[model samples]
Target: MTNLKLTRFAPTPSGFLHLGNVYSFIVTYHLSKKHQAKILLRIDDLDRERVKNRYIEDIFDTLNFLELPYDLGPKNLKDFKSSFSQSERMGQYAKALEILRQSKLLFACDCSRKKVEKMHPKGYYTGFCRNRKLPFDQNETSWRLKADMHQDISFKDLNEGHIVGKLPGILTDFIVRKKDGLPAYQLTSVVDDLYFGVDLVVRGKDLFGSTLAQVFLSEHLGPNAFAQNTFYHHYLLQDPNNQKLSKSAGATSIQFMRKSGKKKEDIYMMIGEWLGVKERIKSLEEFGRYV
Candidate 1:
């Protein structure tokens, strides 16, 4: 017999919810049930600029629409002291930032969008600010974790099998702290997962590139900071041309689909089909049956 584990569907509020997002939620939602596991709705709203209150409510509504009952979050908490909200836990990010800074692995960057354009036409963060010792331009600065030139990380993704990537090449020493004095996604996300003891992160196939950055962050979080967390990067629903859905694209949005006169059943059915759900599932349990 196997022990039950916890899985979570983390969504950022940078944009409106989409079919790809909803399908991923459904897949992860059912998967946790299949294993008799717990599911957490982690609102990755660290990006304060774009988070909208309506979208936040929409997330709760979508979960209810699917009728998937969750265990922990602002929506529900059963004495799980961590009544959750990433935005409320700003201190965690600060501590993680301090750890990285102490290791001398933190670098302040001053390259603005304008600077990147003027310096390197190709635009992959040409390290103009990488070497700059200029005091962080508080108004126009960002921070990057020093990427190991040879560090490679891999994880056994439940749905996709073994996935691999290198830490340095994809996006060199990427931003951990934004110029606005707030932590960026890569740093706080890993920190929150580690601090919350999240061991199963079931998310979109798109974040596979994050393998390097996150694994590296986890590995360096002061030793044994996090347990072995498994990931499931499920197949994403793409367009006819196979371009993965982006928030910027309207076709991916459930709200858009809803506005297009898509019945909620029709929307769920389309999402279910996209996720390879074989039969019509009226509830989360029925959804779990297909998985």
Candidate 2:
């Protein structure tokens, strides 16, 4: 494999950082070092309703406490707010949206969650709005890409080599710009990755569908570098009930664990046990060996 130039830990400050977040960070750190790539700490703070100042502070606090370092991005909350926040890149997102609009590949929809659930049992968008001809500037309307399910989407995978697949049903015609006038996650993520020159992406396997969605979006944005980037989707850390850990599960958050007197080593040990690593992991270096 060719040496990658950069990778990133793109965390959203919607809630406190959890053990699962740290596991993905460790994997990114390991791969960055392995490929001699610089790490960029990209904080996704676009969801204004869920984003809180305390949650943003927790990101910097957790990284400092764990001694995880990044070569690029804001050094603290103040720096992030001043420059690195996703809001700072609204213009770039707008440009990409315009490109899609000009390509005639975007449609405006004003469907509510309840209405969508009623349309299909699985709640998958039935492309009801594809021919609705809703105005792009209409209030309470979101812009969605008109997806071609039969089209093959291909991208490089760090572990399994080049892989190809069709866009998943759940992500069919995924929203690019939300009703609230902000670019959605799928749109912002591709723009940011391309903007920051991130050639290596590390995320959880749960996001494999998202990866495909972003790759498909990249193709529509004209010739771009996002599709060429390599991805690594690591296994998730689940609770005893085999449920995926979420920020809403406060007890599993690093902040909660820290308050409970769990040191960084304790957190690492817990993750090691969950990962089924035979060797005890007491530090980032030890954990690196296993990842």
Candidate 3:
């Protein structure tokens, strides 16, 4: 069957695929199945230091146990695309850098983490390197994309409906590459989606704020950079204590559930109940029908 929609279950195999991951995964699976979409499982093993074999295995194991079939990926480091890791996509990031440079939006600075911590700014990016193009040296220096003053990009979110926020100084001067010769998440993610021709993104609301960063970068991207081709569906996130679950929070671990001999039904049911669709998910086939 030629599935009209294309969705991905991209996860970073850095740590155990936890309850938060499962909730998002199953929701994306439901959306994909509803649209008869081709689901690709891309491993976001960007953090090389943390990406391990066991974690990767657990990702597949969890999906397999839940009967969530994927058409591509779940690939290991060796079986992946040459530059599978986001850190390895330097060339692609460099190309993006050149584009931002041509637009006179590229700048450099040698601000340390300590400096930023001492005087934390409202935005994650402190705008230290927004215009301080001192020099590009391997020994030190980071680059940021110049964000225009009081700029804002408005869009309608599928789930959240209308979202109008000021990205003014927030997005001004973001990083495309890091000092360790690694690409930042925003730059790499945008580049990958554009290059891979991803048409739809079904993810948890956790990534909603991330969409803001992507939208800003998209404004400066070239025509047909694949920026305008995608659609996003940010579903409800799983919150254990009216707060987002974290690794430190014992309830967040899926490994803990598995060890406790939790069945597929247990996990699926929890997801359905939380989404308030428990009555609809009578069976695996019933998921798409109801959603």
Candidate 4:
């Protein structure tokens, strides 16, 4: 059988889905449908302190409300907490870390953020702990990937065309695992994408830096781990002040919009206008035709 295209909509349930979130989802959904790719709803509930049940519920509710469908993921809260949660995938992360460790590409560091900043005024870790060989204690130190110095990495973004940059400059020695024994976002996201065979990733443009880092990490893991994947970093929905819409700012959340009796058609029309479509979009199905 031919390998099918796989795309994922990963949302961290730290806050309610805002307009920016909705726009990204619309883009992802439209693009996935365009390619007839399988879609997965991956909830990135890594931030223990901020991730709440209400936010998780908001994700499902908003997706259902907008009729943005997915092919895989937890059907409900029970499945999310049991099988789909990132917290339950520690062993997989550990195995990947072991690979990095066996290759001598992993190191432990206990440097505070302020200290690291003070050490490198230019704001990148220049191997201060690369040779220090810090002890491996989950409670005491963070595991960082030893990035290649002065190496160039680039990828073709659907929107931006060819995007290129040098590593350790764009992505210094980033954390793969936190001090609390939990897998970091960079590590878990890459592992999940690789394991699930995701060939397409659509996220906000602000994560371009993250995309580069992920590409680098994937290269270290093996050939074509993410090298063959297609990425689309779409434009972010910003506020009047030019700030990206954020849940913390309480900026036009979907939950609030729903409470205010705004129907799905209202959002579709808004997105249609944004996309420069002359005609009003009656529903997501109609909008999909335009995209």
Winning model by lDDT:
2
Instruction: Order the candidate numbers by lDDT, best to worst.
Output: 2, 4, 1, 3
Question: What CA RMSD would you report for each candidate?
Answer: 3.6, 0.9, 3.4, 2.7
The true-versus-predicted C-alpha distance at residue 128 of model 3, in Å, is 2.9
lDDT by residue for model 2 over 55-83, one digit each (tens)?
99999999999998889999999999999
lDDT of 3 by residue, 96-183 (tens): 8789878877777677767755545553556655555577654677777776546665655544555765554444566666676566
Better TM-score candidate (1, 4) = 4
Off by over 4 Å in 3: 1-4, 75-78, 81-84, 87-89, 121-126, 159-164, 168-172, 233-236, 248-251, 276-291
Candidate 3: residue 241 lDDT (0-100): 49
Worst 10 residues of 2 by lDDT: 282-291
Residue 203 CA error for candidate 4 (Å)? 1.3
Q: State the lDDT at 93 in candidate 2.
A: 100
- Show where candidate 1 strays beyond 4 Å: 1-4, 76-83, 117-122, 136-138, 159-164, 225-227, 259-261, 273-291
Summarize candidate 1's per-residue lDDT along 1-291 as a digit string, tens digits: 233467777887667788778778778777776667787778876567797766777677666665656777667322222556675678878888888878877778877777666665555566665566656545667878877546657776665567676754546678888888888888887887776667777766667667557877766668753435777777787765667887889777877776788766777777666656577754445555555
lDDT (Cα, tens digit) per residue for candidate 4, span 1-291: 123489999999999998778878777888887777889999988888899999999999999998878899887888899888887877878888888888999999988777788887776776688889877774569899988657777886765667787664535888898887788899899998987789888988788778888888888775555876788888787665666688986647888888989898887776666566789886767856654
Q: Pick by TM-score: which candidate is best?
A: 2
Model 4 reaches what TM-score against the true structure?
Answer: 0.89
